[model samples]
Target chain A: DVKVTQSSRYLVKRTGEKVFLECVQDMDHENMFWYRQDPGLGLRLIYFSYDVKMKEKGDIPEGYSVSREKKERFSLILESASTNQTSMYLCASGQFKEQYFGPGTRLTVT
Target chain B: AQSVAQPEDQVNVAEGNPLTVKCTYSVSGNPYLFWYVQYPNRGLQFLLKYITGDNLVKGSYGFEAEFNKSQTSFHLKKPSALVSDSALYFCAVSPASGGSYIPTFGRGTSLIVHP
Candidate 1:
């Protein structure tokens, strides 16, 4: 089974603080994606990594960045957490078409 | 570019009755369609995929989807609905033959199973 694990299921941060969401996959998939889900808007991709150290910006990449130092781990960084950044973040990994997702992390910024 | 659409914002169905969630797509090449279900506050779960030959694809939790080539539609269907089956559903599509495999996802459709 392909297992994707997120560092946290829930998170809270103050405004202007930095936040990090971690995701690790056991299947060693070459592609990793980070997305923030909002009501009515669906899943909008924030970033995706095709390979180690290679990253591409998705549709909405305004205040977020990604790091892929290894094949199994991908991290999303919030430069300065804002209230608008509070949402459910999802991480997925896949080599081709079918991606495996982690539980997700609900982030709250106050 | 490939794109997916889930026209209905929400679907209402009674338990034990059949349910269908509509999905349409456009792709430059042969299409690879996928259906995913998302529980509240959780990431999406893979339900099924139509990669090639089979038009009717069965998936987890008794859910199935049919891929129609002429109409360019892939709709998720279930013979019986359970209250537990209520959730948000997303449809995605990617080009099957092209070099690009990145998928475009629909906004999503919320399914509500009435008791």
Candidate 2:
């Protein structure tokens, strides 16, 4: 079975603080993605990495960056977090057909 | 640009009754459609996907989806609904032949099963 694990299940941060959300997949998949889920927005892609050091901006990539220094790990970085950035962050890894997602991190910014 | 739409914001059904969640997609070429369910405070779980071959794709937890090419729809269905099946369902679509495989997700439809 494929396993995708996230660093934190829940996190709270102050406004303008830097935040990092980590995701690791054991399936050795080539593609990893970051997304934020809101009530009415479903899941909006923030960033994705196809290969090591190769990153692309998804639909909503503002105020967020991604790092893929290794194949198994993908990290989402908020350079300076704001209250509006609070969301349920999800990470997924997959090949071409389907994606396996992590448990997700609920982020709350105050 | 590829896009997915879930027409219903919520679907209510009695337990043990048949249930269906509507999903439609728009893409330039052939589409790879998918259905995923998210429990409260949890990440999305892959229910099923329609890539090729069979138009009807069965997946985990007795869930299935039919891929209608002519209608451009992939609606999730279950023979008999359960209370546990209550969750947020999302439909996604990606172009079959594309450099980027990032799928566009629908706004999602909340499923509530009443006893």
Candidate 3:
């Protein structure tokens, strides 16, 4: 079975603070993605990495950045957290057909 | 651009009754469709996918989906419903060829099963 693990299941941060969400996959998949899910909005992609050091902006990429220094790990960074950024973040890794997901991190910004 | 549509916002069914969740899609080329389920406060789980070969594809948890090319629909179905089957269901689509594998997801339909 493929395992995708997120660094934190829940997190709280104050406005204007920096936040990081980490994801690691044991399958060594070439593609990794970050998405924020909201009610009525579904899962909107924030960023994705096809290979180490290669990143692409998804539909919504404002105020977010990604790092893929290694094949197994992908990190999402918020330059400065805002209340609007509070939401459930999910990480996924896969090649093409099926993508395995982590439990997700619910971030709260106050 | 590729997109997916889950027409129903919610579907309610009683235990032992059959259920169906409608999904339609639009893509430039042939579509690779998928169904996913999400429990409360959990991430989405892959239920099934329709890549090719057959229109009827079965998946985990006694779920199956039918692909209709003319209608551009991939509706999820099950023989009977269980209380545990209640969850948010999402439909996604991607181009079968000539595009990145990144899928476009629907807003999702909430399934409520009553005993």
DockQ comparisons of all candidates to the true complex: 0.81, 0.83, 0.82
Residue range A26-61, candidate 1, lDDT tens digits = 997999999999988888999999999999999899
Model 3 agreement with the true structure over A18-109: per-residue lDDT tens digits: 99999999998999999999999999999999999999999999999999999999999999999999999999998876788899999999
Per-residue error at B104 for model 1, in Å? 1.1
Candidate number of the best DockQ: 2
Candidate 2 local accuracy as lDDT?
Answer: 0.94
Question: Which has the better lDDT: candidate 1, or candidate 3?
Answer: 3
| Model 2 deviation from the true structure expressed as Cα RMSD, one decimal place | 0.9
1 versus 3: better DockQ goes to: 3
Residue pairs with colliding backbones in model 3 are none
All candidates' TM-scores? 0.97, 0.98, 0.99
Docking class of 1: high
Q: How would you encode candidate 3's per-residue C-alpha lDDT over B1-115 as one tens digit per residue?
A: 9899898999999999999999999999899999999999898899999999899999999999999999999999999999999999999999989987899999999999999
For candidate 2, the per-residue lDDT at A25 reads 99
Better of 1 and 2 by DockQ: 2
Decreasing DockQ order of the candidates: 2, 3, 1
Better of 2 and 3 by TM-score: 3
Best of the two (2, 3) by DockQ: 2
What is the RMSD of candidate 1? 1.0
